[model samples]
Target: MQIPEVGEPAPGFTLPGTTVRDGARTDGEYALAAEIGRTVVLAFYPGDATPVCTAQLCSYQEELDDFGDLGAVVWGISPQALDSHAAFAHGSSLTFPLLSDPAGDVVRAYGLVAPGIGLRRSVFVIGPDGVVRWRHVGLVGLRFPKAATIRAQVEQLVA
Candidate 1:
């Protein structure tokens, strides 16, 4: 499957997402259509709590304010269940939504599923009009764009 490219509508998804911030935990559905007028950073990782995945997500957390300041909503997607997602969110102190795609439907739609293993570490920067503006699908699970790079993409998309 081909990854959704710039100028293409992103594959819509309404997945279960949870976020805990400042001791308040909120759980709800995260739908792409709902973010139509905002920049959305859709990051698809392999799983929760793995060393590399943990580092990648924590890096996002460290720069969460930068993403928000750029007027972007970042959601971490993985094929893990909501239970795993909840645990990961709580343990990692991730303020951004972590979406659950246990059925792999959404990842498949985005053409992000890995060849023989789990989901490829992928990031899609969607613009305010709901079209994909930039994308990075890592060949391996461990490599991914840093928070600064992702913010730059969001800025470019909105510019």
Candidate 2:
């Protein structure tokens, strides 16, 4: 499946995930459709605790307040189990949710499945209206967009 383009409706999904709340790991189902009226950032990474993925998510966590100020919620998705996500979030002190896509269902839905990598490092910013406003899909998983760049994209949506 081709990735959703900017101005196109983001594919909706509900995935079980783990999030850090008050320094505790909580498990729940996150539904994209439930976030319809809010700007959402969907970040797809290859795995949890990997070097690049760690740096990428931690950087986003550092600027999480800025994203919150812009009314955007960020979600990290990977083809790992919930236990792995919980451990990664706890070890990394990640406050945002890390969704478990063990079957790669959501990854396939977003057209981010890579041959050996499982999933590409990608980020999609969805506007409050549920349309994709900006995206970056890494051909090589070594790098990812900076938090400021993603914030700017969300800012454009609300501006």
Candidate 3:
């Protein structure tokens, strides 16, 4: 599957997701279409609680305010269960939603899954017009875009 290209409409998704708040887990469904008027940061990782994924998400958590300041709504996507996402969010103190894509439909939509491993780490920045403005799909899943880079793209795209 081809990853959605820049200037293209981001693939729409509505998945069950989980987030942490005040040490409590909140579960809900998130839809890409629901965020049409705001910048959206979609971070797709392999699973919950892995070392590099942990670092990536924790960095996002630590700098989430910057994303908000840029008018971006951030979310994490993985092929785990909502329960797993809830646990991970609680453990990592993630303030944003971590979407569960157990069927990998969203992963396939974003062209993120590979043969051996599951989801190759990927990031997509969708502008307020619902078009993809920036994207990075990791070749080896070792690294992803930092929050600052995402914020910059959000500012540039939404400006």
Candidate 4:
């Protein structure tokens, strides 16, 4: 499947995930369609607790308020199991949902499966209208866009 381009409707998906709510870990399903009417950030990473992935997500968490200020909610997707996601979210102090796509179904749907590496580090910003407003798919999986950059894209969606 091809990655959804800017101006195209983002591929909708629902996946079981872990979230930190009220200082507690909660398990639930996260559905993209349910987040309609709000900007959604879909972040696909390779694994849980990996150095680069850790840094990328931690940075996002730190700037989460900026995204929230724009009414954008961020969701992180990975092939790791729910247990791993829960532990990673706790260890990294991430408040966003960490979705588990163990089957790689959602990953493949987003065209983010990195042939031999599992999944590529990618971020897609979806507008309130369900259209993709911006995206960044890392070519080498060694770097990710900073939170400020993504926040700017979300800001545009709201503007």
- Judged by lDDT, which candidate is best? 2
* Candidate No. with top TM-score: 2
- Span of ten consecutive residues with least summed lDDT in model 4: 17-26
* Candidate 2: tens digits of C-alpha lDDT, residues 42-131: 999998999999999999999999999989999999989999998999899999999999888889989998898778899999999999
The Cα error of candidate 4 at residue 141, in Å, is 0.4
Model 3 stretches astray by more than 4 angstroms: none
Of 1 and 2, the candidate ahead on TM-score is: 2
- Residues 1-159, model 4: lDDT tens digits: 898899999998899999976569899989999999999999999999999999999999999999998999999999999889988988889999999999999989988888788888999999999999999998889999999999989988878
51: Cα error in model 2, Å: 0.5
Q: What is the C-alpha RMSD of each candidate to the true structure, in Å?
A: 1.2, 0.7, 0.9, 0.9
In terms of lDDT, the poorest run of 10 residues in model 1 is 17-26
**Residue 89 C-alpha lDDT in model 4:** 88
Error of 3 at 102 (Å): 0.2
In terms of lDDT, model 4 sits at 0.92
Q: How do all the candidates rank in terms of lDDT, highest first?
A: 2, 4, 3, 1
**Which ranges in model 4 have alpha carbons more than 4 Å from their true place?**
21-23
